[model samples]
Target chain A: MIDSIQIRDFRGIRWGEVDGFKQLNLLVGPNNSGKSTLLEAIYLGCTAGQPAHWEGDSFEPAQVSLSGRDFLGDLPLLRVLKRHRYHLRKAGQGPYRDGCLNISISSPAAPLRRFQLHVPDLPILPDSLRDMDSKISRIEIDEGAQVALFACASGRDAGRAERALAGRILQLLSPTQGAGSTRQKTVQSGHKTPSGPNKQRRTAQRGARPSSGTAGPGQQTAIPRRPPAAQHCIYLWYPDLTYHSAGVAAWSLTGKLASPEHVLFFDVSNTHYHFYKTFLRDTMTRVPGWTYKIADCLREVLGIARSFDFHVQFLPAKDNDSLIQGWIAPRDQPALPIDAYGDGTRTALKILASLLSLVEQATADSPAVLLWEEPELFQNPRMLNRLLREIARLIEGKPLQLFMTTHSLEVVACVAMLVREGLLPADSLRAFRFSLEEGTLRSSWFHADNLLSWLERGMDPRIWDTLGVPLQFTLKEQEEGAE
Target chain B: MSAAMGGSIDAFYEGMTEKKILHMLMQRGLLAKVNLCDGKETGKTEVNRRLRDVVGPNVGTKQVRCLVLRDLDERETMERIKQGLQTALQALYRERGHPKAVVRFVRHRAHGNVYLHTCTELDVRVALHIATYRHLPDFCKSTIDDYVLRVALHHETAAALIKRQGWSISSKRIIHKVTSEIPALLKQNGIPMMGEAKDFIHFYAALLRVHTSPAVFAEKILHHAPESELREVFAPLRAAAEFLQDASSPSMPGDRLPA
Candidate 1:
C-alpha cells in the first residue's frame, strides 16, 4: 500500500499530500476538484517507478523509446490525457513557481521512491496526425491501436484529437502506473508486468531540448532510445466513463483474472453486460458455487423478499452480435432479461459480482485494489445503502484496497451509519474532499466522527458548505391575520 | 458556495438554545454555519475529539476554524459539586477511620471569562463565552439561559409570552416590574413568588403559575421575541462572527467576546 503520497505540479494539483492511508479510501468532492486527477497522479506515480519499459513493436518505423534517467523531459502532450500548465497564476493565487510533475510515495516496499516526469509545455503540433509529414506519417498507420480504439470509445472528439497527435502516442504507451513490477505485487485487470528487477531505477534528469531540425516546430520531437529492464507495464482504466449503461472498457481486462492481488478499475465501455458475463465465467471456473453466492448478494442488495437466481443467458442479437445477458428473477418465476430490470439493479449486481470476483481471488500476500468511481450510479437511496452494506460486508476481512468517489449523500450517510453501527470499521475508511483552483490544489479529510456528526444530523458533508439546521429567529410577533 | 475552497466557520454551539441564539444574533452574511456540540460531553478529551472531527489530520495545512460556545454556568453549580465531593470524602474517611470532623468549607471565586487560544495543540480557534448581563453582578457568569433571559426580557418579550400563554401571575405587580427590571431583579433581588432558578423563563413560569418544561417554554419565549430586540444584545456574537469571517487563519481572541 502507498502509505503516504505527495503530489507536486501534477496536472491540476500544484502541491498537495495525503499523509495517511486507509483500506477503503473515498476521494470525494464537487466535479473537477481533482478527485479523478489525484487518482491519475497516483496511478502514474506508482506505475512510473524505475526499471520501466514499453514495447512499441506494436507500432512501426519511428520506434519511440523513453526510459533514461537523464532523458530530456519535454512537455509531451498526449491527446488521450487531459493537459494543464505547471505554473499559471489565477485570481488570488500568490505567484507562479517553477516545478515539474513529481509524485513522491512512501510504502513498505519503497521507503522513499520519487516518481518525476515533467512533460514540458509544448505548442500544438501544426498538422493533424493523419496528415503529418513523411517523418511522422510512418507511425499513424498503427499508432497505439489499443489507445486509439479506447480513446475513440471514450468519446468521439477524444479519438479525433488523439489521431491528430499520433506522433506522441508512444508516450501514452509508457503505462504511467505501478512500476518496478515486483514491487507492484498486485495485478490490475490480470495484466501483469512479471516481477523482475527493483534495483535498476533512476530519475529522469533534465537535458536541454535537441537542436536538430529533422522535425520542425509543432511536429514530433521525441528522442527515441532502446528499452531498459522492463517493469511495471501496468494498465490504468481511465475512470471517465464508468457510469451505468456504458459499454465495456476497451482494455480486454475482463479475461481470466481469477488471481489474487489484482487491481481492477471497472470502466466498462459496454454496459457491463458482456464484460461481467466473461468476468463471472472466469471467476466460476476457479471458484465453484460462486453463482449461488452471487445470487445471495443480489438478493441482499435488491431488498427483495424472495430469493433470486442469478444466471447469464447467451443470446444472439439482431445484428448477429453475441450478447451474453444476465437473466435474474424470483425463484420459480419465468426468467426476465436483465434489460427489463431497472438500471439500478444492473449496476449494483455488476459491482457486487466484480467485488465477489476480487474477494474470491484475493491472496494474503497482496491485497487487491478495486477503484470504483461512483458506486451510487443509478442506485436508489434505500437500495444504495443496502448495496453499500453488502459491499462493506463482502470486503470486510478481505485483503482489498477499495478507493471510490461519490457525490451521493446516501453513500456518505451510509458509510457513516455503517461505521457508527459497527458494520464498517471506522479505521478502514478515510474520506477527503478536494478543491483545485487554477493550479493550487487543496484537500480536506473527513474523519469518521466528522461524517457521523454532519451526516447523522442530516447535514450533507459531501456538500458541507450549506448551513445546518435552519433556525427560527422570529422578530416581532406574528401579524394580526396570522394564526 | 463553489468559490470557497477554504473551510467555513464551525460554530459549535452548546445545544439548540445556543444554536438558536447565535443564528438570530449573528447576521447571515457574517455567520457561515453553526454546528451542535456533542451531547453534553465534557472534559479535555471530548474537546480534542470534537476539534479533531473538524480539523482532521490536515491540521495546520487546512484553514478551518471553530467557535466552541459553552456557557459559563453559575458559581452555585461549582459549589454544589464541592459540597457533594466533600460529602463523598467524608463517607470514605469515616469507613477508612480517617479524620473528618474538622472539615473547613472554602468557596472558590467564580470565573469571569475564559479565553483559551488552543488553536496550536487543537487545530482551530476555540471561543468560550460567558453571558454577561451588563448590569448584573461583576463575577457572575451563568449558563446560556441567562443570556436567553436577557434577550427574553428585552422589551419584555417574555412578558408578552406570559400574557399570551394565559397563565395567572402569582403577583401582578412582580410581572409588571419584571417586564422592565428583570436582569436587576435576577442579579440583586430575586423575583417575588418566582423560585431561585437563574433563567428568567423558569422564574416567569413560576410567577405565572404555569406548568410547562423550561425547554419548551424557552423555545416559546425565544420565538416570540422580536428580531430587532434580539439584535440589541448581540454585540459579542457580532464580534465573534467578524473574527470567524477570516477563519482560514486562527487569530487572537476577539476582545469583546461576551459584549
Candidate 2:
C-alpha cells in the first residue's frame, strides 16, 4: 500500500500531504474541493512512466500561437513545448527552464523508490519555419543523444515539403536505437511500415528525405542534424536500480503500469451508455461466473432485481453489420433497455461490472487499484449505504485497494457503522475531510475510533462543531441571569 | 456594601429545590443577590472540586462563600443523608487542601421561624444546607408543587375543571395532567373555553411551547412571582427565606432581626 502521498504544484494543489493511508481510504469533501484533482494526482504519480496515462489534454499550454498556416500540424510538438514551459513557470517564479515531478513509493519489504520526470525546455523553431507562410526548405532529423532537431529552409526549395514533413514525423514516432549501433535500412518516399525492428531501422536510416536523385529539390543530401540543447530525462532511484534515461522510461519496477491490465478508473459523469454496454458484454463473455456475482451485488445494494442479456439479430451475409442489443431484465417484468432505468442504476452497473472484471483478474501476488469518483451521485442514502457495504465485502479477501471520493455523509456514516460493527477494521480504513484554505486544499483526518464514538454519541459526523469542548459559564453571571 | 467587597455568595443545588428557594429569598429582599450554580448534582460536585482553582483563596480581602443544597429524598433515615453529605464535604475540603478549616452549625431566626446552616472554612469560605421538605413545618411534602397548584387552581375555571374531570382525582394531579395536555388538545381542537379558563390554560401552556416539565413550570412561576403574592401563598417558605437572608447578610451579624 502507498503509505502516504505528498503533492506539490499539481493542478490547483500547491502543497498538501495525506499520510497514514490504509487498505481503504474514503475522501469526503464539498464540491470543487480538489477531490478529483487529488485522485488524478495519485493516478499520475503511480503511472507517470506510461505515456498513455499522461493525459495530453490536461497539459495543454495556456497560450497557443495561431500564426502558422500549418499550425494544426505543428500542434503536437507545440503542445509538448508549451506544457513544459507552463509547468516550469508554475513550479516557481524564476528563469528555470525545467520542471520536475518527484514521486516516491515504498512497500513493506523494499526501500522507497523515487521517480523523477524532468521536463526540459521547449525546442527552438528553425530559422526557415520561423517566418509565416514560408515553405519548408531543408529538413534534418537527428537521433544522437536522444534529441531530434528539425531544420527547414523556405522559398524556391519548397518542393516535396509536405512529404519531407510526414517523413520526419514518422521517424519521430519510431524508437531510435543507441547512437553507434548501426543496422540502418532506408525508407523510399511514399511507403511507411507499421512497427518492427526492420521498419524502425529503415525509418531511422531514411531520416526525413528520400535518397533518389530526382525525388525533390532538397532531397540530395542526408547529413544528420545535431541534437538539441536541452534534453528531457527521467531519473529512477531504488535499492537495486539507479539510472537516468533521456526518453520515457519503461516502468520495469511494476507490471501493472507496464501492462495496465488490472487498473481501472470510472468517471461516471463522462461514461457513455455504449461504453457501459460494451463493458457488460466483455465481462459476460470473458468471465461468466462474475456475471451472476455482479448481478447479485447490484440486487443486494440497489434493491433491484436485474440480469444482463444481449439480443443479437443476424442479417444476410452480404450485410456484414449485425445488431446486438443489451437489455436489463427486471424480475417478473418485461426487459427494459439499459438506458430506460435511471442514471443511478446505469452508473452502479457500470461501476460494479468494471470492479467485478478487476476481481476476476486479480491474484494474490498482484492487487489492483480502482479509483472511483463521485459514486454518491444519483444515489440515495439507503442505496449508498448498501452499496458501500457490498463494496467492502467484494474486496474483502482479494488483493484490491479501493479509493473513492464522496460528498455524501450517508456514505461516511455507513462506513463508520461498519467500522463500529467490526466488519471493517479501524486500522484498515482511513477517512479524510478536505477543505479549501487560501486557494490550497487542506485535509483533516478522522480516526476510526473517534468517528465511531461520535456516532455512538448521536452526533452528525459532518458537523465538526458538535465535537468541540462544552461551553463554560461563570456562576455569578448564570445566577444573576436566572429567572 | 457587600458589592464593594469583591467576592460574591454562590449557591449550588442538586435540583430545583434550592433554586426555587433562592428565588424566594431574593424576592423577599432577605438576600440582595445570590449567584446560583447552573448545573445538576454531578456538575455541581465538579464545580465544587474546582472552586479553589477558579476563585483562589480570597478576592481582595473578601472570601468567596458557597451554599450547597440537597434533598433528603426519603433515605432510610435523615442521619444517612447527613453522613453522605459529610463525606462529600470532607472530600471537597481535602481536595481543596483546607483540612483544618472550621465547620459549624449556625442557626438563624426570622419571622419567628428557625433554619439550619452548615458553614465550612476552606481557604475560600463555604456552606452546605439541607431541606427536608416533608419535615418542614409549613412547607410540607412537595412544597413547590403544592405552591404552584394552589396559585394556579384556586381560580373558578380550575374548580370547574376539577368538578368535571372527577373530584376523586387530586386537584394537583388534575392540574398537572391538564397543563401537560392542554396545549396539544388546544392545537388539535382549538381553544374550548373562554375568559379565566383560557388564562388558566395559557398560564401552563408553556409546558408544550418550550417542552419543559411540570417541575420546571413551577420553578419558572416561583422565579417570577411577586413578594406579596409569594408571602400570601406560603408563609413558612417566606420565613425560611428570611432566615437565609439574615444569615448571609454582613450587616445582620448580631441582633439584626426584630423580636
* Model 2 lDDT, residue A447, Cα: 60
Q: Given the true complex, what DockQ would model 1 score? A: 0.13
- How close is chain B to the truth by TM-score, in each candidate? 0.56, 0.51
Flag clash pairs in model 2. A137-A153, A138-A153
Residue-level error in angstroms, candidate 1, position B160: 3.3
lDDT (Cα, tens digit) per residue for candidate 2, span B122-200: 2243444444333123232322344554555544434444454355555565565665555457768876532222234
Show model 2 residue runs off by greater than 4 Å. Answer: A49-260, A270-288, A305-326, A330-335, A455-460, A463-483, B1-259
- Tens digit of per-residue lDDT, candidate 1, span A1-483: 444444433344443445355777888877877776656544333322222221121221111112111001111112213222111111111111121122222222221122222222212232332231243343433212112011111111112222222223222222231122223221111112222233212222111111111211212433122122111112222223211211111111100111112555543222343432334456768766765677788888888646445454434432223234556755577777666877888887667766777777776554466667788788788998898999999998887777788877668778888899998888888887776665445666776876765553444556435535462212222112110
RMSD of 2: 23.1
Q: Model 2, DockQ value? A: 0.02
